[model samples]
Target chain A: MTADRPRTSLLGTTALLFEAPGETTLETQRRIWAVAHEAAGFPGVREAVPGMNNLMLVFVEPPRRPEEIEQRLLELWNVVAPLPIAGRCIDLPVAYGGEAGPHMADVIEHTGMSVDEIVERHSAPTYIVFALGSHPGYCYLGGMDARIATPRRKVPVLKIPRGAVSIGGSQTGVSASDGPSGWNTIGSTQIAFFDVNRSPPALLQPGDSIRFKVARVLR
Target chain B: MIKILSVGALATVQDLGRTGGLSLGVGTSGAMDPLALAAGNILLRNQENTAAVEVPVFPFKVRFERSTVFAVTGADCAGRLDEAPVLPWWAHRAEAGQVLSLSHPKQTTWRATRAYLCIADGVDVPAVLGSRSTQLRGSFGGYEGRPLRDGDELPTGRSNGRAVPGFGLVPPGLALPLEADGVPAVRVLPAAEYDCFTNSSQDALWSTGWKITAQSDRYGYRLSGRELNPLRPLELRSHGIVPGVIQVPHGGQPIIQMRDAQPSGGYPKIGTVIEADLWRLGQAPIGSNVRFIRCSWDEALGASADIRRWLANSRRLVELHCGERGGR
Candidate 1:
């Protein structure tokens, strides 16, 4: 798919940012991945981190000639194609509402849907992983049905448990560890999002897809 | 090995941090003053990335379990070995059962809050995700995944007996200075959302004096300065962020993310402190004022090169001094 002109900016001396097209879109993210893949090959490149629609290039050794890197990135974006959605599919079993879902009532009140309807709507769509941020192994996902969309909590909770599935400002994510969050939680999964013992500790990666299954429900 | 007799506030094991893990939502949690960490390691002839005990709050006391060479870097904390005075930034040898103590720092040439206790061959800790630095939020890595406390025992990496005592190198802060128009300042490069801020906000960011607030820690520094208002209300998505990014939230005060900051944030980033200048920010004491100097990409890279040059020179000097002693 054709994308808008990729916007390039310097994060600092050691890091570079390339923003693709507009807002959160799969096409733009795919373009970002394409650029990220290409930028990773550049000299002095240390890490190529992808976001919702942006790619961050971190260099251990700052290139003496930065324009060369920028030019190369621009050139790559010109010939960019959608990166293949190639990753493992993971099934996340969620227990919706009650103690497991601390903020499920808030979500139901905001969406004005029956608890069962909300669960059906949430579990139906197979969300696409946009990026990982906020915490270790926390996946920022897209493709949530608009019917269940809810704004974030005004005052964030101090400590949300790990594996808590949440929604915040049109996006859905799972807590990687026990930490504070602003997202309204509706359910939680028992699976670990991060394990220090594992290689690439995060369970999900960009381009991976996740399907939520209702394991149980609590009133 | 060493046993903690008394842990003064916050003390954790840190190296250069886990760098390649940000993509997986893991933050780079390392030494706040990496220059000190590097210099301490160099004094002991240890690897640059070797883990060291980062002691922020002082009045700390530890007892060596065996004979070992060590160095204390960063703040001049008036350290002592069983009541005998030990110089800051100098390498020293201690015997088994000898206790080392550090008191409140006496700021002389540099205003630094943290001090690093570096032992030869680095601290003996299992590297988590390729680093020994403590990730406090996740509660893993370093010594038992937490700060050192009384009775905590820390092992030492095996040294090659090449480290020498009674020698020292100048602190990197004194060796490489960063200033702007006579004011100690850190260079900053504008970030992606720089233009979203108001003209006054930008001007104040560059021109005003920002006092590091008490709320500051390894996670970030909350600076009390001229209010930085954005041009409009921006609803930003959570995005990738690195340490040194200066972000402004609804309160108008700007916060500079530090080594332990989260990997991503939704705040509007006005500027990013140059990577080379981060050490200066790390040493800036709470309640102390600091200024921001706008610099170009090339200048920022040049600063990094300067740090490399400094490190290389220090390494060579230490090697020469230790080599002459013939592996004492």
Candidate 2:
């Protein structure tokens, strides 16, 4: 194994996490997705969920020999290649600023940019889905412009409505459900990110790409 | 069928939890005290993962529309069937129109906050995403996807007619006791960023008693104690987190995620309360102080084994006792 190979840690006896070393990149995330696919089929493994650049393997039952599984994961990490998934590019029509986005002014204050400029930069890039988490159908997307990055709120909001598009630090994503959050909301989308009645509930998955379409600037 | 005459807040139908949905960001929303749920099911001869009503608040009242067997487990709620007192952790057959009332938890024997109402069969709710657990965030599953309210009626599954009344089992909390400095404690295993915290902070985590703040709930337990400062500020990318993960935000107060915790988070993790002991923590009352006992990987696994053994033994004993009694 290399000096900075992936590290493994236990998330209690319920699950174990395999975090890739170095910077978080699409390349590393792709590898994590690949590992997740392979690990999901392993004995005693219930689910292999891909995070930003990490993979958490939840156990159906706590393994008697966790070290053996760790060794196998280590060996698998060394040999497994990045598996690129053929994913769909979803277009999300977003209404930027105004009351829908309660924290647009905060983002403006932090980025020192005009509302129009902020909207343009935010929608410029087609973001890739790094993972689906936080709440049902919520996507952790990559490729947000660094210039628009804003620090999370010191105190998290008691509740943010679903479809609220927001940015936190270098990451950006849309809230899939109405719940508490600390991210700066910049816009709102009408797309239902998740529906339990639908097969494969989450609207987006790892490897999918999202394009933000300017529906109407509420500002 | 059972009609909710009076119900407290946050009472919902739950099974073993919704599993295999983490990748889609769906959390495992289920009973906080799963051990009590399991024991209740065992007493009534229901399936291990059968759905039950998890009652966190007190003075819950329900009327049996039909004669059915049921068991009340978890907190000793001083349940009464009509005017007859019903023993905690015992199976009983309720006649049609009989009202079952559970008062405030006495805390005489076990210091618990929640109670499980396990019917002979289970709560008949449509399983969404392969579980009957109430997904509060998504607003789906369980009884109309919400907590049981007054006048709400829930259908019970077809009873197998195997459950026999007049039998009881010891509560697992008493059978499997864990403590540190005479304070209730749960085992913890260091997590991914355990080394990032300063030595003193790490030491304090193991040594101090953290009070469960009023903010504690199914989502997470906000613990108040000595600040757990890291070696330096740390920023983490969002990742999958399970129940029992101890996350330290910028404020350094540790928040222990529970069953309804988001499927993912970005806060730095210092440790996780082993899953086997999550039931103990779940039953811990608000404002109560809980100690953390650092444990090795092997020891954590052993604790899990211990719980499994307890359940198995209890199930076997219940089966033997019920079999001896035969049909009443």
Best by TM-score: 2
lDDT per residue, candidate 2, B1-328, as tens digits? 8999999899999998999899989999988999999999988888889999999998999999999999999999999999999999999999999999999999878899899999996899999989999999889989988888999999988986999999999998888899999999999999989999999999999999999999888999999999999898776777778999999887889899999999888788999999999999999999999999999988988898998999999889888998788752
Alpha carbon lDDT of residue B165, candidate 2?
A: 91
* TM-scores, chain B, all models: 0.97, 0.99
All candidates: DockQ: 0.45, 0.63
Q: Which pairs in model 1 have colliding backbones?
A: none
In terms of docking quality, how is candidate 2 classified? medium
Give the poorly placed runs of model 2, Cα more than 4 Å off.
A1-3, A112-114, A216-219
Residues B210-275 of candidate 1: C-alpha lDDT, one tens digit per residue: 999998888889889898888876546667788899988766888898988888876678999988
Worst 10 residues of 2 chain A by lDDT: A1-10
Q: What is the C-alpha lDDT profile of model 1 across A168-216, one tens digit per residue?
A: 7677888878876668889999788788777767788998989999999
